[model samples]
Target chain A: MSSSTQTAQYNPAYHRFTLFLAICTFLLIVAGALVTSNDAGLAVPDWPTSFGSLYRIPPMVGGIKYEHGHRMLAEFVGLLTIILAVWTQRKEARSWMRKLGWFMLLLVIIQGLLGGLTVKMRLPWYVSTAHAMVAQTFFSLTILMTVFASRRWIGSTVTLTRHPDPGALSFRNLALLTVLAVYMQLFFGAGFRHGGLHFFPHVVGAGIATVILVWASFSGILRFGNIKPIRGASIAILGLLVIQLLLGFGAYMTRVVWGKDAVQPRPSMVATTVAHVAVGALLLAHCFMLAVQAYRNLAPAAELSPADQKAVVA
Target chain B: MKFRFGLLLILLVAGCSKNETPPASYKPEAPTAKIDPSTTATVSGVVTYTGDVPKAQPIDMSQDPACVLGKVPPNFGEAYAINKGRAANVYVYIKDGLGNYSYPTPPPATLDQKGCRYVPHVLGLMVGQKLRILNSDPAMHNIHSMAHENDGWNESQYPGGDAIEKTFNKPELMIPVQCNNHPWMKMYVNVLSNPFFAVTDAEGKYTISGLPPGTYTLGFVHEKMGEKTLKITVGAKEHAVAGPAFSSADIK
Candidate 1:
């Protein structure tokens, strides 16, 4: 997670493009949520074409509009990821960053193919849920790129490695565990959304993810309280986590509080669900940023003083 | 950067639009049609079954006694109602050979849910025809229309709620509408591209009128039984095909 030595010679424009890609990927995730919530999977009925037409000459109204628009946004994001990969390969001074770009591009390509498979397979429950799950991972990758390319992250020097306090848990390890748990919860959320068996567990998984995230945040505050990046991300993650919880309950209320009358989704339900999805992406990204920061700021026991490190065990 | 952000905003705005509203109780009024009385013909037939069909299953209504209150106890949703070897609830219609003849949109067939069962076990309507599903029970009922050949929709209707009206945009032989809450409540709806179909009455009788002169394929279908077809030609006036009567042997 430490910035590459060559990162000193950075192209500001490249950094900006990375941020742009991150934002684009975020939007794409939200668009995907809208499509699923609207149940517009069969609106277009055909892939790579809208009713046998190349363009939307006949404007799509209603459900077809949502399905087709998602396709367009996905295509655009795919192109942007491709450009980001090639652009970094051509101009980036650091090899790791360039490879990160390529990794993102590869993930996006796989994601697009999965999306196409979802359509071709007639929107089977498993394929559709996989599509949702991959979007989240792809979103994580884009957010990682943004975190790596940030000026604050690249400008800082990490000569002195900050290990956790004696007898305290490793900050880096805690964050890594938090990220994995959050992603697991996201996977469960995807299953829940698609009407699968993991629904109740998904609800329970939220509580587990929340506890882990808060623990990681507290550890971050205790160990790197004075550091601006750790302090800021911790606060942001905590705040976003609260908002996400509220949105999740609000979504459940509007979606399933009524038993037999749960067929039609009100506009409020749509808004809450979409917002919950967006906030989830944001939370995952924030958690990942914390993980990256942990790796950069905190080193293994060997990097600390021998007496202090002796008090800490792996 | 500002320009790029603005462009992103524009793209987002362009991508999102209002979602299609749920089924509303609005039925298109049927317009007057121009059927040439001279060339119009009629096709009539009877669907007779020859076998000891299984007894209609007893529908349990204890989950919601409101579904069976004041009604006959154990009044099951009759699957097969045959009278003296004549099968009822058979849907008879023209399968093919009718050249371009457009009919006016008829009013939606009302599928009422009373006593926790669909009033009519079988209903038939033309493509683009409206269907109004009413929930007469003092409980919540959801209409889950399962169609393979056309779009399927599931909507909920509360007691005393307005009827949920919907129309099929394509032709499907039969769409099963079920109440997810009351498992025993079920109905089958047949959607045809044209209004040349009829359901057999208790006497296994059907008559499809207002047909233009042409050779046609007639189709007969029963809810829990089977389907059969016939080939016939109709000339001017009320022409009836000779006794190409349909028997249970013809049902596959």
Candidate 2:
């Protein structure tokens, strides 16, 4: 196969790996839910240890189940990403792909350390929340890697007229704004997840950010008709926003639906918190998609001259 | 290939070192309390409330630099009663002269957060034993307990979460427990060598039972209220009443 064709080939392993990662991410999130649901934040008091003993598995107690389960899932994911990175290095010739593999490896290690620190430091809210944020980012980056590796996500050359379109900047701005807004929203969401509702402001701030995300999605969809994917992503974001909003309310109100008061949070909080995290992951993915779309539209391609290709090699 | 193989073998051997067990014949002493049993028996008391405690101030943990600007609730490190206008959640125990009875291995204990407050405002547990910390809220809460002896451990838990199980390797007198998430949520954990400690009731009364018929020093520890000590004699069959008249100011 020609280099271009070979590069373009639909690698089944890439798809399989992406799917595997997706499933694993889902399971990991569920494991996180179990951890939270079981109230097992500090089952292992020492970071990376159960009762100060390094080798002893944390007993399958309520908190231990969650905390240790989280640790185990993290290790599983770490190994998976290491394998994925190694596979990419072995099979991929692209420098970007190689760099991405290395980056993924670094991120997985950092993520693992962060998990340990969260335990060692007794799960400080900020560190704990940042730990969650990095996990979502890791998930998004892996998805991006999969996208780049897939045949459909081609870095295609596009022709545009010299006359600039008036709506181009708006689209660019909207894309950038969406990324920033979604990230900020996720940060606040992390605060909410880690703040323990003792701080009323964080609670209110998260609610406000959710509201803005909903509004931004609606407005972006209505205004950006030229960018189909942008509009689609916006609409999808809107839907997730609604679900998250309802999840929050359901978490708050449905205690009575389960024969409890509104003030009491239910097991649904675990699922809702996880879903909230997952949606944030999706938003980051969409942001990456928009960035790629924008970059592709603007970059000029000359079929990489032989000299450029040689330079890439060196 | 030989180098890599040799390195892997070395790593495997290194990992195997973790599995070595200690000599089985070596017997260890019973998990005893931190206090010297021979010293004057020091008495320590903790008062506990079964009802809700009113927040002296509103604690808000809404923004970054968590709890920086927010008002430190009156109970930041202090304990008080909420309903019935009675002081509850007080502690009075024997701190010195514990020479006769060694502190037992702390039995498994649970510190549950139900309705935004620690279920038992004052928890009594042994050194080197596990104590389960449970969070029943739907909100994220950070449990920051400042222990003088044990390495201070802090942790954040999501709601409907399981307990944060922890063990203090060393004995601690009175570690203040605070929720950094909720400045108002505060409690105390008293780590002792013996279970002879008792928390005071709403009536401002406390009692230490199971004394081994000897003279010992007694002490009381209350958050913000400080600690108190007195010498007392424990008879095998005599029931002893500590106090209802001790003032918070006096303890401080």
Candidate 3:
């Protein structure tokens, strides 16, 4: 069968809604950034309640706005995801997308529960990290949905011929290695972020990720005939890693500069933290590309080139 | 086979029962002494930092090479103070005489070691109360009580193991709870004279009750803070006194 026949067709409405969800997810991330930076997570001082009341009322109450506002936005994002997933259920095109949609819906709900648990548990580090990670994972799914639903990637296959070289196997291995390294590095980064094991480990993890990313880029270029997208992603990864490293250093050096407390927030501290978190999201995207490329190459090609197009296959 | 099975079942039940009993004993105990409900009075006030709540020094837990190698271990939050005689955190409460009234019990307390620090620098317990002192990290910790006016004991807990259940025999103004294994791990347990009294919050707020409707002198104190006295009379309704707010200088 042709690849297009075997592959699930893209649903435009579903694609649009998923993109919208992705946008909202980004906003929620930014809002969460603000919340963490401001230390507003505990500002309201109660879980599922604002100052002993169910909902926040305006003008006079402090902390209600930031805390409840993040909550309200989170609920809206959850609702959007549920709606998108349910709507796609009828389409039933790609079983994987449908499954992922349902999974995303379930994860979003669990993520909310985890958020409440964090408050209930008084911000235990592990639960808090899980909550942050679930958000990142959800964002990745939305990115995946956007990619699969797009006209460009749908029905496409990666081939060793397109990536043809004596080193196709090594390039493939390098790609898989890149994903594994990035993932482990991301996990360490998460630990450092949540465990509050600041500075040194973060630097070490970033430095390792940077080295692997550069090695992977050089390996990809040397082996894959200089595929621009892969090269570009590697370059982006390097740039982000460098910027993230500097931000980590900046977070330490300029920590007391704002003087909220040596432990508390300064503008620079807030900005750097948000940047650090955001870059992790971007790094995950680059890692996703590495995995996708590897998966595509593993599968047989359906679209024949000009030379092979005329031949009738047995 | 039948005879062996019977013996194994018997052993299993006995092992499970005894293993469960010890952890159940971890629950905190309310004071044995009680005050008459009719006589109980309440004293409450806000604690606020007027000048400055002295900035806590940042502990570079990573300062030690052993910590980086995950050997000597690091202090998670604040390390022990070397020269400072007055401890920063000591929650003083009454060890006895609080009439029974419904109150939210404190969260199951923990002394989690995260990235090598003991959370909650001070833990408050009633004189007859039980405290669950937990060790969260993978490091071995020995909880040592340096009690000046009360019985002192020290014990160690292995990583991922159960927290030790400890109680105080009598009231103590303040006692230093240290980790002998990790010198930097230090906490304070304040044993109260009356179960009715509690340390004020960060805002300097406290409530005391279960007093007979008569004038009694109540003292407000913290580890680093000196005593503030107030005379209170409880009528049909509980009495309230605005806790004395002191500048950081006044604390001395």
The numbered model that scores best in DockQ is 2
lDDT of 3 by residue, B67-167 (tens): 34554532224322212232333243433333433433343445565434566766666555667777666554456676756555545455667877776
Which ranges in model 3 have alpha carbons more than 4 Å from their true place?
A: A1-12, A45-63, A155-169, A196-200, A225-228, A256-263, A297-314, B1-252
Provide the lowest-lDDT 10-residue window in model 3 chain B: B79-88
Best-performing candidate as measured by lDDT: 1
Error of 1 at B134 (Å): 23
Question: Per-residue lDDT tens digits of candidate 1, residues B1-252?
Answer: 366346434433432311243433324345445568678999887777776654555655654545666876755445667788777787788888876655788887899987777878889988778888888887666577777766665555667799888888767776877664555566789988788888878887888898987798888776544666788988888568522344545433
Residues forming the 10-long window of minimal summed lDDT in candidate 2 chain B = B58-67
Residue-wise C-alpha lDDT for candidate 1, range A1-314, written one tens digit per residue: 24455445556887888888888889898888887776556555455665567665334443445677788989999999889999888877678888888988877876776676555444546556767767887888887777677676666654444654433567777888878887787778777787665568879998999999998888777667765667777888899999999998988887766311323234676788899999988888888888878776667766667544433222
Q: After superposition, how far is residue A313 of candidate 2 from its true place, in Å?
A: 41
User: How many Å off is the CA of A107 in candidate 1?
Assistant: 0.9
lDDT of 2 by residue, A1-314 (tens): 12433354457887679668756866776676555443456555556565556666733433455676677778888888888888877777666777778887887786676676666556556666766767777777777776666655543312221111134344445556666666776666666666533435545755666665665566556544345545666777777667766765554443223412112123465565556566667767667666555444322224433332221000
Flag regions of model 2 displaced more than 4 Å: A1-6, A46-59, A155-169, A196-220, A251-266, A297-314, B1-89, B92-150, B153-187, B190-198, B201-204, B207-252
Query: Which TM-score value belongs to model 1?
Result: 0.58
DockQ per candidate: 0.03, 0.06, 0.04
| lDDT of prediction 1 | 0.72
